[model samples]
Target chain A: MRFALDLIESFRMAIDAIRANKARGALTTLGIIIGIVAVVLTLTAANGLRDTFRQSFSAVGSDVIYVSQMPWIMMDDFFNYRNRPPIDLKQARELESKLQGRAIVNPYLGERRDAKYRSEIMEGVQIIGTTEKQLHMSSAVPATGRFLQPFDVTYKKQVCVIGSEIREALFGSANPLNQMVKLGRTEFRVIGVMEEQGGSFFGDGPNFDRQITIPISSFVKAYGGRHGRLNVDLAVKAPSSESMEMVEYMVIGEMRNIRKLRPTEDDDFAINKLDTLIDTFNNMMGVVLLVGLLVTSISLFVGGVGVMNIMFVSVTERTREIGLRKAVGARRSSILFQFLFESAFICLLGGLIGILLSAALTAVINATLMPASVSVLILVIAVVVSLTVGVVAGFVPAYRGARLDPIEALRYE
Target chain B: MAVIPEIKETTLSLNAIDKTYDMGVEQVHALRGVSLDICRNEYIAIMGASGSGKSTLMNIIGCLDSPSAGAYYLEGENVAAMSENQLSEIRNRQIGFVFQTFNLIARASIFHNVELPMIYGGIPRGERRRYAEEAITRVGLNDRIKHKPNELSGGQRQRVAIARALVFNPSIILADEPTGNLDSRTGGEIMGILDELHAAGQTIILVTHEEEIAQHASRVIRLKDGEVESDLRVDDTDACIAPSESLHLVGGATS
Candidate 1:
């Protein structure tokens, strides 16, 4: 009970002292403010980047695996990966037959090309050449007309399905179905329009809404053969998400058999999944978060030093007052707590202002660039960090004040 | 020497107390085997020149400093062996101090300054306020309770300090040169409050260098060097004796 009363008295004294020196208190907290702002911004930006990655990778289908020439995140031995033979259309067909009953295998090719309709032209349009099975491997579905049919691939038909972005760019509100559009000098009729799927902020993954889909046979003839610059990448979807591992093993075993690779040799093809991309993204974000916090902590340490300096000055200026308090029955612990409370209160004030400023910055980021929001967890962390800084910084000066001899302090002019 | 009236139940006793200060090359003895007894409700004045160690004795009596040798007993409790925190508790509960400069925290209101001792005493806020108000009222500063010390006159500030010293109802009120900073008229008014407190049976030990201030106490103890030079009780008719003659008489009586 006595300790509680002492704490309350100390808190009141701290507040009184701060109010008496308002300008000094405010100036003392400036370092804390800048440090808090930097810390909060770094955490918020990491959150935004994570959110963007999650949204972008969602469209890639978690249960689907891709067979590509190279790993999505290559480390070393770049030439070894480059030397591997491309997985061509024949290999995709054989794999499809091998996994006919267990999974849906779709092979596709993509390249950036210019698309034109009437006088309107969209540059850097992602044109994807795939078979009818492509619809099963993607999250986007045609919102109007119909998707490509197997007959289109069998006859090498010139019909195409455009994404929402392409539809808006070339035809605007005009009916795009049955209209002919030129894609890289070849004309094809637009048979469908896919629904819009928003792109990721980081642009690290495919943007589904900005692509154009055409028959793979026509793509092979017009763009290039499998032996040309275009490589065939196969997408294999498991029967169920829970059975993904089982399907992956089966696909790998079948690919090894078809490629005639011995058990002693390493598989030349890379099996890419959403997990690999997500893992790589998380690792990169971890490094960024670590570096950001490390740099920001330096400023916070400097801020703490500033607080310590000011507290020492305050202690010296109030030496007589401290002596008076000691003479009037105040314990040494009471004096120590008084100064500690003052510094902590200042830092807490700075932390609150920093949070408000960062929240405003997050709003601006959301409005102009990416999706960002400050979470409750971040606010809690910011408050804890500031209080810790205050306590650490105030300790030395407060200790010195508490240890002062009452006689000498009273005599101090 | 007048009889001290059977010692009247000793409230404090010091046994050959010695205080020394380390001055690097040679040690300075502030008090050399000083011993005395103070009974309840005794208004005693300790007088000496600047280097005569009266301040050191006052500090020891107030529990602000411990003696380097010998024991100090307040109400028969050995204070010399107490821990620092224990001494702080003793000061908080048993001793009140009024400084010549008034020692009121300048930024605090009169009420807050008076309530400070009780706050450290850990009294509940409601009770603390009531006691502080009563003490302030006793000093006739009820209307100035909210005023800061800087806003008050020297006499008023001294009264506030007296109120602070009285709020705890300590066993003894230690006033060291209490009116040193005041003009004669204001100083008389401040001393008048101490006189009233003494009349009300409050034990007060006054330390002063001024002969006029020392005359207010019923018993006066004079110090020279680090030892007691004379101890005398004043009779009403002998209040105006010449300083040299009074000292000679008191010196003869003590010897």
Candidate 2:
């Protein structure tokens, strides 16, 4: 009870002192504000950036491996093997044949196209060509209609699946299935429509919501590209979690054989795991956060120095108070605690305000600005750092104030 | 250690105490073989001139400074060899002080200043406020409790200082030139308050250069140069000058 009372008194005194000298306290705490603001803003930005990446790689499934033109996490080996050529479509097919019952292999072809239905049009939508296996590798799912089947591509038919965004644009109130849509200059029947994919996180690359998909064989015929020069991605599912390494090895050997590479020659292919991508992005964010914090800490250092200067001035101004306290039976330790608590309180107050402001700003961003997120973990860290800054800055002045002699202090004019 | 020799279970004691200051190569003696004793409820004053070392002697007696050589006892305990921390403890728990300038925190309320010592003593929060208010009320500044030191009159500020001193229930109240900053009229009101406290058996040590201020005490000790020139007991001494009636405030008799 006594301790609590003393602390309350000290806080009251501190607040009164600060209020009495409004300009000085405000100016001194400005440095702390900047420090805390910097910490909070930087943390929020990093959090937003992390959220952006997490969403940007939305098509990368958590438990799935995406084998394409590049590795998800770039290693020294990948850079060192930069001379490697793009993995071909035949290599994808051969890997499927070799892995037979052990894996689920799906091949895809992406063709850039535009479409219109009943005077409704969507520009720059991709006409993706892929097997059913490709659907499970991404976070995408069909809305109402079924995905393309083997029968749709068996005779190189011109049937297509339109994404929900295209369906919305082309057919407002009607179901898109069985509806005819113009795919570039070619006409195709829409057999399926996808669900709305929120925030097109693949950003500007290939917005699935604005997409339409045709069979791979039909795309090859319609686009009329080099048949052997396939613009395709192969997604191979391992038999189980434990089979991931075996699946990778099996695909590599099959690709080398299909590409007819000599025993001494290096083959080309990029295998990407969702976990590796997540880890790499997180590591980069850690480095960015570290650098940001180091720079922002400069303001905190200045704030600490400000606290020191202001506390020194306070000591001088309240010299008689210190003396009076000493004369009243206040121990040196009590004096020390009181002064320390005052300065610490000042910094903590500033820091908490800064954090709240930053949180408010982040909340606004979360509500309207970015699809990415800032975590509570980062907020917690920033608050802790600000508090430590205050405690450290308070020590010197508290010590000086505590050490004053009652006689001299009281006698001070 | 205090200069006044204490009684059995009483507060304050001093025995043949000596104090000297080293002025570089020059030795300036402040007190030489001086002895005094004070029991609870005694109101005494020390009178001196400009260079009479009264202030230095008061500092030693208040435990704000240690004597160069002396055996002093406070409440029957030998304090001559007490540590600085111990001296501080005694000063806070056993002695209250009032200085010449009122010495109230300028921007603080009368109540705040009164509570300052209690805060240092680490009193419980609710009780600190309660005692501080009571102390303010006791000094006849209850209505002015929230007023800042700057807003207060000289006598009122002194009252607040006295209330602060009295708050902790110290063994003795030490006043060092307590009336020095006030006008002659305001000074008497403060002196009256001290007298009342003394009447209530609160031991007091008043240090002053004014003979009138010295004469208000039950005993008067005069210092000359660096030694005690005279020591005697006197009663109704402020009455020696009846012209002080205009300065006395509240219920005390006209001086």
Candidate 3:
């Protein structure tokens, strides 16, 4: 009960002290506010990116694995994999028949190109070249018309499925079904408008919403002349009954056999999964948050030093008051807590203001650009960090105040 | 000498108290082998020149500082062995101090200034408020409870300081030049309050260099060159207490 009263008294005194030196206190808190704001804004954006990433990757189907030329997170030198052979149309067809019951396989690839409808042009729209099975494998359902048919691939028909972003950019509000749009130099009839896939795994490049999908044969016919070697990515969807590990094991074995790898030779092809991308994304996010916090904390360190300097001045200015308190029976701990609480309260106030400001800014950004929201965990962490900074910064000065000799202090003019 | 009534309890005893200050190359002796005893309800004045260590003696008595070499007893407890925390508790519970400058917290209200000691003593809110108000009323500053020290006159500020000292009901009220900063008239007003407190059975040790201030106490001890030069008791209608009491003073100092 007495401890509680002491805390209450200390808090009251702290408030009074802060209020008395409003300008100095506010100036000291400014550094903390700027630091917290930077940290919060960066972390909030990172958090939003992580959330968007999970949603986008989950939409790509968690059970599906990709067979590509290079690993998503490259474990070794890239030059070593340059000699590996690419999986072509013939290999995809053979794998389809070989693994019919175990999985649904779809070979696909994409390149950035301009898509045009009349006068409207959408630049950097991903032109995906894939078979009919990608509609199920990629979990992209047609929002308007039908997806690509098997005939479209086998007969090399000029038919395409556009994403919502391409639909909006090229056709605006017009009915896009059967409307012809130019993918590179080839004009293809829009068979379907795919559902809105709003997020990109790699933040800026190749958003799913801005893609146009056509049959692999039509893609080869349209853009095959531009590149000498076109590597097709194979997407394999495993059965719900089999665990991903089991699926991965079977896929690895089949891939090695098809590539004619010796028992001693390492498998040349890389089978990448969504989890690999997710892990790499997480690692990148960690670095972003770490660098942001580290840089901002330098400002916070300056702020903490400011607090310490001001506290020393405060103690010196109130030497007589401290002496009087001591003479009247205040313990050393009481004096220590009083000053410590003052600095902590100042930092906490700055942190709260920073968070509130960042939250407002984040809301504006979410409305104007990307989707972002500050989480409760970040709020708690920000508060804890401010308090820790305050305590650490306030220690030496408060110790000096606590240890002031009453006789000498009282005698000080 | 007149007979001193030995009926009341002894509140303070300082035996062979010595204090030294190391000024780097030279050692300055503040108090050398000083001993004294004070009983309940005694209004004693300690008198000395500036370098005679009267402040140091007051500090020791109030448990603010320990004697360099001596056993100082307060209410039969050996105070020299007390820890800093214990000394703080002793200062809080047993000694009330009044400074020359009325050392009240300048930013706090008169009521809060008076309530401070009780707050340190961990007295509950209701009791502390009541005691604070009563002390303020006793010092006749009932209307200025909400006023800060700067908002009051010099005499009123001293009264607030006195009320703060009284609110804790300590064993001794140690006033070091309580009226030093005030004009004679205002100083008299403060002295009147002390007189009233002493009349109501409060033990007070007033430290001052002025003979007029020392004359107010029932007993006076004069120090010179770090040793007591004279110890005397005042009697009614006469300056000094009878010769037998004077002999006891000599006996007490020598023995």
**Could you give the candidate ranking by TM-score, starting with the highest?**
1, 3, 2
Better of 1 and 2 by DockQ: 1
TM-score of candidate 3 against the unseen true structure: 0.91
Predictions: Cα RMSD each? 4.2, 6.9, 3.8
Can you write out model 2's per-residue Cα lDDT over B1-255, one digit (the tens) per residue? Answer: 322223223456677778888999999988887766666677788888978888888888888888888788778878788887788778877778898887777867788788877776667768988998888888898899788888888899899989989998888899999999999999999999998888776889999888889888876777898787766557542212211211232113222
Per-residue lDDT tens digits of candidate 3, residues A211-230? 89999998988887687778
Error of 2 at A144 (Å): 5.2
Q: Arrange candidates, best lDDT first.
A: 1, 3, 2
Model 1 stretches with alpha carbons more than 4 Å out:
A97-102, A119-124, A200-205, A224-230, A239-243, B1-7, B235-255
lDDT on C-alpha atoms for all candidate structures: 0.88, 0.77, 0.86
Off by more than 4 A, model 3: A51-58, A73-76, A109-126, A150-158, A168-174, A179-188, A199-204, A217-230, A240-242, A367-369, B1-6, B236-247, B250-255
Q: What is the lDDT of residue A79 in candidate 1?
A: 98
In model 2, residue pairs whose N, Cα or C atoms come closer than 3 Å (at least 3 residues apart or on different chains), thus clashing, are: A329-B92, B4-B13, B4-B14, B5-B13, B5-B14, B5-B37, B6-B12, B6-B13
Interface RMSD of 2: 2.3
lDDT of 3 at A320: 93
Q: Candidate 3 DockQ category?
A: medium
Chain B TM-score against the true chain B, each candidate:
0.90, 0.86, 0.91
